[model samples]
Target: MVDAHETFVIIGGGLAGAKAAETLRAEGFTGRVIIIGDERDHPYERPPLSKGYLAGSKERDSVFVHPPAWYAQAEIELHLGEPAVDINRETRSVTLGDGTTIQYDALLLATGAEPRRLDVPGTRLAGVHHLRRLAHADQLRGMLTRLGRENGQLVVAGAGWIGLEVAAAARHYGAEVTVIEPNPSPLHGVLGPEMGGLFTQLHAEHGVRFHFGSGITEILGQDGQVLAVRTDDGEEHPAHGVLVAIGAAPRTALAASAGLEIDPATGGVSVDAALRTADPAIFAAGDAAAFWHPTLGTRLRVEHWANALNGGPAAARSMLGQEVSYDRLPYFFSDQYELGMEYSGWAPPGSYDQVVCRGDVGKPEFIAFWLKEGRVLAGMNVNVWDVTDRIQQLIRNGTTVDAERLADPTTPLPE
Candidate 1:
């Protein structure tokens, strides 16, 4: 049990860390709270980096999790640009990058994840970039704006959410864009082929070209600047800039170095239902935590915004010796061009037996549900507004539904 005067330290000043700090104060903890971050900027929302921020529709201050004054007002020490390098479990202390050591009664690791980089040659070129931080997005936005003026091509590697969103923003800036994905279709692994095909058609309508079933063998460049990309098939595509959005790897080195249990499958800190790590004094949240999900009956790590937002408070409550379960339905949303979408619940690959669609796919607006044994496991609504609550309720209820009624738009979801 932690004393009222003991210090609580949090690593990684992203949304999860910020939210955790907020929860601690809100819960009336009088102990000192400190947030350490590697980046110079304060905690900020990352979702806008690929959407409004990249498109220049949102200002720099709009992305911050809280204004600069909030941390000081809350009496939370902000350790900006200083990363936690080592964790000493025996001493219950953490060593910062600057070699300062701080003792903690309780610690939260919300280290988050970093973007995976393409290992191809010329990745070091001036025109090549990856989107994981505000600085990266700022650089890409500048490049896209210049490319728009020059009518240059923007070659994006990977057709995942980040890649597609970047492509949409670049297209909106009037830059010619091409997305390269090794998968057969965009988001095929998550949404399945049918819904993935809809995204393909949507991008095609906006004049975005796709190179499917192909991997980038090399990034061609001249004079330290990217010029084009060479695919495995020996085809060269023009490129004034390149955005690599393959995926993200969890930031688990600190947890692993501390001899904490790490999930080898997901490269995340292994945690129980309460988000407590193997060490009683330590806990993890957000992207770095592979937590046991009671509903799914398995361990899973989510990188979505909602998970961090909700998980922070849950982790804090648990740390305060309150009974808590961080098992809310995993939810996420994305916006590209004119289309907006929200997905809820867990539908692991190959776990669902069938998919039922409500509304017309041709209209490019509908809700698709993944089911097993006629029970809804997960659902996604694309370009359809105000139905996410119903979709989540359907999954939560886990009631068997008639396929005919599920497919019929006129039939109410609860019916």
Candidate 2:
């Protein structure tokens, strides 16, 4: 029943778009498949950009989603370094930067996101870096290695995940690291002060400095090279380099211009559970999609690796007219020094009633749960092995258990 004449087009070079094309071919779709990418490099996973790759623990080839030859073998039409400039819904066509327009039977927008640049002065100076692309990682890696040899300092802006991860990598390279955050604690937006304190302690114990309640006011440079970064706290930290890890903003201009429905709350292309937009032929997934999650009963736009790894395939099946319900919870993992943590589900600061931790906080090995009215909303495991499946199950089932039992290490999660 497959139609060899149908054409499916994807607009992103990231993991989401690449995986979606793979899924389509795997599902026996003999039709034309095309993927448009703005970046020159082939699609690659992003986690190692700030973690293993940045820390020199992984090779450059390891970051790619697939071998270069795989795309050609799969018969995927790739337009590398060419950005899709316009999406004309009337003709179901997309215009490239080179002025070539391609017609498609179905389209997917996985444009992904870009790192938010600091609005402070002297940001254009050399040695002020950000890690979003593979080239950035390559540059940062060299800088860290040189800084380690020269005994230079690295001032990191924003104590979010990126800031912390890069700070850890800087320390791993034997460079002095200082993290500046505007909030009272690190990761304040997601984990709140209770859990954020743990990371603050972890970094401090490893010789990393934290300047809480501070924001970058300006970056001072001489001869077009970074000298130091000044903070709002009226302090100037000397730095040979600076890493701006403020966060990322999803790229939504293209979708909005196409008159596609975008979720105002998340600034993402609004789509149903099947990842289909207002126009049946157009779909979206990955970071650009603010999709209706059937299980959570709310719209979510996740920017983690797992979402794209799974979201792409789900969108592919839906494009093939399969009944798809994308209800997977938001999940992410981090590596900082000796501590490795995996957090599942979403429980923002004000949404959770209390955070309960099981096991030894001193050993820094435990599982923490964010509960709302005794119902588990999120769970994080630090240095603890396995148990992710059970944690996700508790969230999916909305399980309510006694506080005492939930906190006790001896109590096994019931089936």
Candidate 3:
């Protein structure tokens, strides 16, 4: 049992840190808990920043995980805009950016990640932007609203979730968007070919142009303003503004400098099943921690909102000496140009021998199941959310269902 005065220091005031503090209090720890984040605002949801928040449909406070007053009520001290500059494992203390060190009985490193910058010339121009923070989204929204054309051309440099979601928001404002992907289709590197094909056709139907198999060599600009994007094919595409969404790397400098073990394979901090690092006094979670998956038998690092919110409490329990392990059934959702897509479970590499499609793909309403050696590996639902619950259950129980029944469209995947 922990004493009431034992101080718990949590770095990174994102979803994971906030939830950890809440969980500690809920479990009757009553220790002095503090959350330190680099962002000035209260911890907010990143998913909305690309979708509703970027579309001007919501306010800044709408994305906050909890209001400012909530922190005071919970007695969880929040060090907003203050980042942990250094860590002393021997002393068990964390030095803040303002040059103050705090001792702690336990520490949670949820520093999250920053936007990966592009290396090409003219990337430093004014109109070139990356959406990772709420402030960034606000600036992007203003830029899009200022463009003021019914079919304004907005060029996206990557086809990741953030890029696609921003494209959907731009299209909502009647902007003619072009997505330039190095791959043949969106999400090809992550979801494979067939699933990415569905997204390609879906966007094309909504009047979004795709420049597939093309790489941006340079982002040319005039007078500190982005003017056009030049591809490796020597074709210059006119773009009012360019968005780089090439993904992010783990922010592990503080922990690494403290002599923490980082996994070379995933570039994430190595954590045990209990979310603890090499030092039992320290732990990590969210986008910065990588753990081995029991099902896939490979290290997994998921960058999704579900992982932060769900995995946060699990890490908190482990830090409090509870034996809970964070082996969640992974799930992610994406919205693009009026299409809703969701996926669950780890899709093993080269696992699917047969893919059964239920319902019509052309109508934009269907579900596809990947079967590996007569067992379910992963499933994707387009507009069908009814069967997702059952599909999730089937995945949990490792139930094998009839492949023929899956294709009938009338009968969903069995539970």
lDDT of each: 0.92, 0.93, 0.83
Model 1 clashing residue pairs (backbone): none
Instruction: Give the Å shift of residue 94 in candidate 2.
Output: 0.6
| Order by TM-score, highest first | 2, 1, 3
- Write one digit per residue (lDDT tens) for candidate 3, span 186-205: 98776778778888887787
Q: Where is the poorest 10-residue window by lDDT in model 1?
A: 1-10
Worst 10 residues of 3 by lDDT: 144-153
Global fold similarity of model 3 (TM-score): 0.95
Weakest 10 consecutive residues of candidate 2 by summed lDDT: 1-10
Number of clashing pairs per prediction, in order: 0, 0, 0
Candidate 2: regions farther than 4 A off: 1-4
Find the candidate with the highest lDDT and give its number. 2
Query: What are the clashing pairs of model 3?
Result: none
What TM value does model 2 have? Answer: 0.98
Candidate 2: clashing residue pairs, number: 0
The CA lDDT at 190 in model 1 is 81
